[model samples]
Target: VGVCVIPIRYIGRKMLARARVVQSSQGDLSSTLQENFSSQRDIRAFELEQQQIRLFRDRIRRYIQASIGAVRWQSLLTPLIEFVSAIAMAATLLVGNMNGMNMGDFAALATAMYLCYEPVKKLGAVHNKAETLNAGLERINHVLNAPDDVPEPENPRSPAAWKGEVEFRNVCFGYQQDSPVMRNIDLRIPSGQVVALVGPSGAGKTTFINLLCRFYDVLSGSVKVDGIDVREMSKKELLSHIALVSQYPVLFRGSVADNIRIGRPDASDAEVEEAGRMSAVDSFINETGEGYSRMIGEMGEGLSGGQRQRVSLARAFLKNAPILVLDEATASLDMKSEEQIQKEIERLASGRTTFIIAHRFSTIRMADRILVLEKGRVVADGTHEELMASSPLYRELYNKQQMVAEEEGGAPC
Candidate 1:
């Protein structure tokens, strides 16, 4: 029961965010635009953003419909409970008749006992079943009405073209009130540099990335990009400057072409196919029975891990953003696949500010500078050779990754 309520946190957050979007767009939702909503506004446009909220509401409504069915099933149990109890009492009365107790005495007993049993049994049955359904309804209402995460401001300034310098000045943050995950983090990444972030689990490496994305604002201090506070920039403008490919790739249900085109929605078919070829997905796609038109199932289920990574790389290529974040983007690929993808990344990384987060030291060896983090602090920052001499933590992590590679009967670089 406790575990069941955990997912409600995310569900409630999404629903509330959607509600805000809808409320923000009401003035723009005119009768003329109602007929062809998509044609009138882009999904990110203020007017159409409310559709996400409506979709969320519809989802909850559908769940409520299903819950009603469950409630009916629960109610059916009440009649069964009464029937069983009544039958037991009736058998007791019949036995009394066979034992030669006077029929009048048995009739009096039955009449008096049933009067107590019926009301008591019915009330107990109704209350028990009602309580169970009440819990379900409470969870439903919680998910549908929980308060939202603090929202970004409306009509924020659109940031100018970025030079990719990022600064986190004396930042402190915690998801909860009493405990801070990152404490007084201060760092800077200059333009056109590749910085690698590496740390053990829960050391706040990913949290740093989240701050850069502004997914959650800092508790104190600021994250500035190109000398301007990221919080002041319009969310769309801030995100337009970056492309991210994480360890777990995400793909929607669509043809291969549609997946790649997500990076640049207006990309021509030729351009989309070319991006796939650059990512080394094109050769396999051409050999596929359906070519680029082949449908990728939910989350690219129909494709191999390597295939999915290549498609994600193709998306980054299509996005062609100035700031690139590769969060172990090639983590799951075979050596041959990694080598091919690395070449593509190297080609793209020129003249762009890149942040590479990798557990494998081999992946970060080529990075211009490695930022070693420990307990939310930058413990060491330098090149691979420099870190080997200066930081034992970096060396230990590097040697561990090397040991794993050797244990798998693979050659170490």
Candidate 2:
């Protein structure tokens, strides 16, 4: 009995290892399928259907090959165990024949051995199932054991009537400590001022806002709101006072009204419409097949870029928080759409401490103050006109955008 179980256990362990690889391949295949389905518009626009099909087919083949590897090991186990049992049965029969045992005794012993064989086979099959399940469970356990990047403090404090004053005091941060993204950033922004952060792509403009929102805490100095370090406040309580409109707004499968109400779930329908109207979304919502109740496809795929930005703006307006941050809110809009959305953004930012991350000369000109970052450090800080006169980099960036605007047959910002 012990000898028979040995080979079965050995095969089970080997199958378990292979099962993990099969599971990994399946995960990759599933994620790719979902991404392709969600971005079908982009795929069609780029005319990459043949390329996408080829990639998907290759992914499926790899998954099949991995599954077959695990299955091969599983198939070998039962046959091997049965062969071992046959050898044992033959030995027992020969011994019984040499001792001249009675026919009845031999028959009884043979019947018992045959019956045990069925249970042994079933046990081997159960081991195969256990191996597969254990591989899955191991993945789940790994995720469960992972720690958060910014964990909540054991004792947290909520702000008392925060007046929306934001300050970055000698702050420095990086996703990787060795490769710093923002360095020695010190700024004092008064309440209700609109500040624009402008720089080249790697200047850490996005990371700056991300740190302000406590998405990632600073490595050295501190970010403060109303003179209180953000780290000292509860994340939820801290973020409740601020509203952000990101470069790529996220919208799930839901009605337009539902998506807007995500900012404040308990807000009344009238409030949602009021926000939509304020953000220039109400005009277009009426044109949709279902109006405010229109069902959005995954990632809001059915909506145009401007339409999606309007929805995102409506959500931000709905929040009506004291602080607003726009990460290139109008970057992808058309000239007319950009002008309209810019108007809506002004309304949303009114009376709120606002931050803008932009490259458009038109957008940066509206900022009360502009901070020019270079290689993760602030190189210049002043109004647009002041920077144009004093900072060569800022002047060059403005000139580039002005040329682009002129080439597009648009007025210089």
Candidate 3:
């Protein structure tokens, strides 16, 4: 064991480093694969398949080089350990004879030495396993050792209730310091008001909601909930006041009942059913003969787009949080489904401070207040009619959207 230990520690340091490199390369390659697959349609439409393939092949080659380097070091350790064990055994026999050991004593020492070989062999086997598994270990340790970008307070306060009045005070942020996502933004929404955020693709609409949820610490300024700084509140407190229905509703692998119950774990069967009914999914659930027993695949893969959206809405209904945020919530649905959800969305927004981030003019037209953003600034704030009269950007976006609607032959909302 001693003979094996010395070589494994000293000779294996470089091997561990190589193993980590291999793991990181594999991770990078996997991430690239996921991105490429998710955007395959865009790549094909843009005729960039060859470009993507070239990049992917380059990543794969790097992964191959890293794997070979790691394996080479691990393979070297096993032979070196065997050579040291053989020498140690020979030295032990010679020393025993020179020290004048009797035959019986020599035989006993010989038996002990043989027993030592078993553990040393096992240790060598363990070393090989460790060398390969270190690749996985490095992946785990990277996440574990990473510094938290958003950390909880040492002593966190969970508010019992929030009035849902949101305030953004001189707020600013950037994923990179040189390019700000939101800039010196100041806004206030009264409790229970329905607000719509309209902006060009990169005008920080999503970033606003992220800051509101305290997903990242602001580089400067503060976002408040009911006059309390969101950063000061615990995660539970921050989540309790908001019920979110995103553009793509992500569901876990569970019975339909289990998924709906996630919003309020203590909800009874009747409560879950009522929430589903309100969200317009109860009829379909009962028709499938599964009622609440139906199991959904990951990300609700088996369900229709409308069904998934309603499930998320059902979750919000059950939670009954004071703040409702629907980020492109019904954008993927068909006209029929969109209309159904729009009614549900209105019901969901009633008497709650609701914020929506859909680009469709029809969906946001009824909002009590609309904030038009451009280049990280709120360029206009008003009711839809007021915005149409006041903001050229809003008018241009609305006219383009109306033309598209006309071409699609759908009546104006």
Candidate 4:
């Protein structure tokens, strides 16, 4: 019986190690499938059908191999235990005969050994199950036990007055510690001001807004809303005062009205419809005949890009926050739609602090002030006319865009 247990224990260890590999390979295969599913359009457009198919096949093969390896060890455990038990029984019978034991004595001893063998076999099966379960739990715990990079404040503070004034004092930040994306940024945006951020790609325009929103903390200096440092305020309270409409907005599976009402959960049906109307969402909803009750698929599927942009704008309108951030809010719209939404955006920006991040000079024309960034620093801060005359970098960017618009037979900025 003791000799029988040795092989089971050794094989159990091998099963445990291989089980981890199987779990990891299974996760990798699942992630690849999800990525391919979500990016079907890109896959077709890039003509990568064969490549993706091959990659998926390789992952499947790896997953199968890992599974087989784990099973090999597990399957060996039961058979090896049974084989050892047979040898143990044979050895007991031979020893009993050599010792001149009576048949009754030998039978009793054999019965006890058989009962013990049954439990040992059952325990070996249980051990195999336990190792497989442990592998999955380890993966889950890896995520659950990960450290939070953005920790909450020990004592959160709220502003006595919620003004729209935003200030960045010598702010510096980077996704990586040694390589800074934005450096020595200092600016103050007063309430009711409309500021446009423009630059060539890789400039710090998005990073500036990210820091102000506290999506990431600045490595140096501070961002202040009203008179309080944003780090001192709770994330929820700070975000409540700002409305952001990104280039690509995410909409969940729900009715159009339900998606819009996410801006203000307590908003009435009338208020939601009003917001939809303000953002020109009502026009298309009416065309569909379902109006506000029209269902939106996951990630705003089954809706055109322009319609998704309008829905996102509707949310911002419903929120009516004091601070508005539009990151290429109208980029997805056609000329006619852009014209209509531009008017709505102007109305929404009235008496609110607005920050617009756009590459289109037409979009930035309405901005009271424009800040041009180069590399990681603000290179120019002035109106359109002032920038064109004084800042060569800004002049070159605007002129290039203007020339492209002319070549494309679009209206000049």
For this target, which candidate reaches the highest lDDT against the unseen true structure?
Answer: 4
lDDT of each: 0.75, 0.88, 0.84, 0.90
Cα-based RMSD of the predictions, in order? 16.6, 2.4, 4.4, 1.9
Model 1 TM-score, 2 decimals: 0.65
lDDT of 1 by residue, 1-413 (tens): 12223233333343344333333343234332454443444555557557766864565565555555444544554455456556756776779968988878887877776676556545545554455445556556878888745456665765466778888999998878688878888888888888899988788877888888887788999998988887877777788888878668898899999998988899999989888888888778878678899899876868988789888888888888878888878887777677777777888887788989888766775689888888878889888889999999988998998998787665674
Ranking by lDDT: 4, 2, 3, 1
Ranking by TM-score: 4, 2, 3, 1
In model 2, residue pairs whose N, Cα or C atoms come closer than 3 Å (at least 3 residues apart or on different chains), thus clashing, are: none
Off by over 4 Å in 4: 1-5, 404-413
Cα displacement (angstroms), candidate 3, residue 358, comes to 1.8
Q: Give the number of the best model, judged by TM-score.
A: 4
List model 4 lDDT by residue over 50-144, tens digit each. 99999999999999999999888888887888888888889999999999999999999989988998888888888888988988999999999
- RMSD (Cα, Å) of candidate 2? 2.4
> Candidate 2 on 213-319: residue-level lDDT in tens?
99998999999998888888889988888899898899889899999998889999999998888777878878755678988987887898888988888888899
The backbone clash count of each candidate, in order, is 0, 0, 0, 0
Instruction: Between candidates 2 and 3, name the one with more favorable TM-score.
Output: 2
Poorest 10 consecutive residues by lDDT, candidate 4: 1-10
- Candidate 4 has an lDDT of 0.90
- Report the C-alpha displacement of residue 233, candidate 2, in angstroms: 3.3
Query: Residue 351 in model 1: shift from native, Å?
Result: 0.9
